[model samples]
Target: MRSKTLGKIVLSLISVVSLGLGAAGPAAADSAPTAGAPVAGKTEAAGKGGPEGIIGGETADSSRGMAALHRNGNFLCSGSIVDNRWVLTARHCLYPEGERIPDSQLTVRVKSLNRTSGGGVVAVSDSRVRTEHDIAMLKLDRSANAEPVRLATANPKVGATTYVFGWGRTCATCAPSTVLKRATMRVESIDADDVYGGRAIRTSGLNGRTCHGDSGGPLFKLVDGQRYQVGVVSGGNAGCPDDSGFRFASTPTSLTWIQNVMADF
Candidate 1:
């Protein structure tokens, strides 16, 4: 059985702290340095390569609804456009467990593959966190011109192929990528727990895995040529290229909560 908590996972592998500023080195000059509050109850292995970006991934051709979250001008986490004025991302990306982040400190860039340029930036007007999960929804100050991603209604089958996108580091000790990256992973478990002990989907890298700076990124599955979001990046083994595994907050498992939360927006 998969461990039901992050503490067990951390004992065997490193936990992803913050993909934002200071987790990776400096970012490109055009963008502010990336950083986010550290995940609660997790420890990092100093100088050890950890989850921050896509390892063995390639440049994304397009990312229609992707959102690059920033805090005080610093890159923080990844998110997906679920509505014209709403985004879905990891709660940890906003603050430590049980803590809150002010709306004034958060901003989002959408409809662009590059986080540094070529997208509309909007301030976060409000946010709501799921008390039982790692996910959170942010309300934008204005409607985004980009199309929103569809949320999967069912759990992804085991061994199903999935794609993940992020602007996190390409490798441990590397700076966060300016361009978005995509990787292939296989569903390993539908019953896993995220860093915050929320329901999660576990995946193993087929061609690549998530690293730092990738927290809150989307895990997508294709159906009948259409893409649907199934999960959100949560945490993974220390090394991105390792076989330990990666965990994502399962979107389908929390669909009701998501709909309820979005209803208020």
Candidate 2:
């Protein structure tokens, strides 16, 4: 199934904003990519954040190290290797809000972003938007390099460093940059009072956050030698620097509940 109309639907997707960072400039992130850094090249737009509210906002700095979720050369979002065969993301990523998209109409390009690559990239669909889940599983066209990320059954530390990558917008004024957009987003617990997050959804991290075109990206938590993909790059309040410029993400653990959907394949 394919989406027949893709107009304003992109703007209406569900969004979650979390976190607040203080300092920790980009020059300071030489060691490990912080889990929550600013959006690459445009921290000012989303404004400054609180102490624990961090990010890895250096997409251009490291491309090889980060995984490319799209098939061709570029898309707004980037994906992580949750499994050799499946990539987790938001359902709105492929379908968006109010759009009529059929899963068969969607493609989960593994490494490439555009359409020129060899074609090993998977074309996934048949997504299931569950009652308690905001996650979607993309079926790869074929098995990938096979270095899958390890999922944390336990709770992820609030201040833990995490990396988010995607083909999302760099800045509001700047044209959406090509290549993968990598950012470090710190994990922080948003107030339970936040609208997007309720009992089923535990949210976290923000400040330098995501934007248009970044739909369906992956938020990864590195543990041991493996990366645990937790959050999907969803949408936000139109452009960055939204009033205060901060935002949050639906808990990555929500992705875990969708396991049975990908279990067989």
Candidate 3:
């Protein structure tokens, strides 16, 4: 059963204390990364690697918040392969703001994700979730079959590096639209004490963070030969300049929750 209330909060969330929080990390991290993949993160939204890059440096000090979005005019979000057929994402992405959408109205694509370019496509079969927990699982018609990202079994750690990917607005404190976007962000920390503590990464020199189209994106880390998905793009403070990056956070990683959900499969 869902343990918390999952709803959309379009409010701008900054890292200041007394804000909100979301359990950015999830069940998948307990495993490992995709096989023979880069040890660094390639967290992006739409297709395979959405709009993110390796965490070479940091970005501005701001952020944005959003739900599900598109990539190259295709329906997709930052998702990760969990188990043989389930792809995990934020509850809001599957059910934006926790609002449910008819299953028929939802689909997924994991092909070539390019904003400047474009590439492959995969169709999701079904979806399941724990709304209160801010988590959802997308059932793919076929398994990734290739090197797929896994989740962490480790406990949520403070100062741990968290990655984020999405197609939201490119600026913090700016207007957001439902367009395909992508970027690699960092997790300054996972502040569970805050209202929606999904503290994610910020750009190093940019004045913005995850925007509107970024919701339901992937958050991962490198392990072994693959990328291990740990969180989904949630929300954050938007509206910033190119010099002051923005904020973006994900859900926390929980072990029991992941095992329980995947056991059914």
User: Top TM-score: which candidate number?
Assistant: 1
Residue 53, model 3: Cα distance from true site in angstroms: 11
Q: Rank the candidates by TM-score, best first.
A: 1, 2, 3
Model 2 C-alpha lDDT per residue in residues 145-262, reported as the tens digit of each score: 5445555554456676665555444454332334444555665543221112221112233434555445445556677756565555543444444322223334444544557767
Off by over 4 Å in 2: 1-56, 60-76, 112-119, 173-175, 190-208, 242-252
Whole-model lDDT values for every prediction: 0.69, 0.40, 0.37
Question: Can you rank all candidates by lDDT, best first?
Answer: 1, 2, 3
Candidate 2 lowest-lDDT run of ten = 19-28
Q: Could you tell me which 10 consecutive residues in candidate 3 have the lowest summed lDDT?
A: 32-41
**Best candidate according to lDDT:** 1
In terms of lDDT, model 1 sits at 0.69
Better of 1 and 3 by lDDT: 1
How well is each residue in 1-265 modelled by candidate 3, as lDDT tens digits?
2112213323322111111211121112222110000000122222222223211122212112212223223333445555545666655554433345555544444332332222223445566765344466766567544334556655335444444444333343222222233334334455421113333333222212454444455555555544545555544432222322333233344446666766775
Pick by TM-score: 2 or 3, better one? 2
Tens digits of per-residue lDDT for model 1 on 3-68? 445663422122233434421111111111121112333334334443344567666767577888
Candidate 2 C-alpha error for residue 181, in Å: 2.4
Per-model TM-score, in order, reads 0.83, 0.62, 0.56
Worst 10 residues of 1 by lDDT: 24-33
Model 2's alpha-carbon lDDT is: 0.40
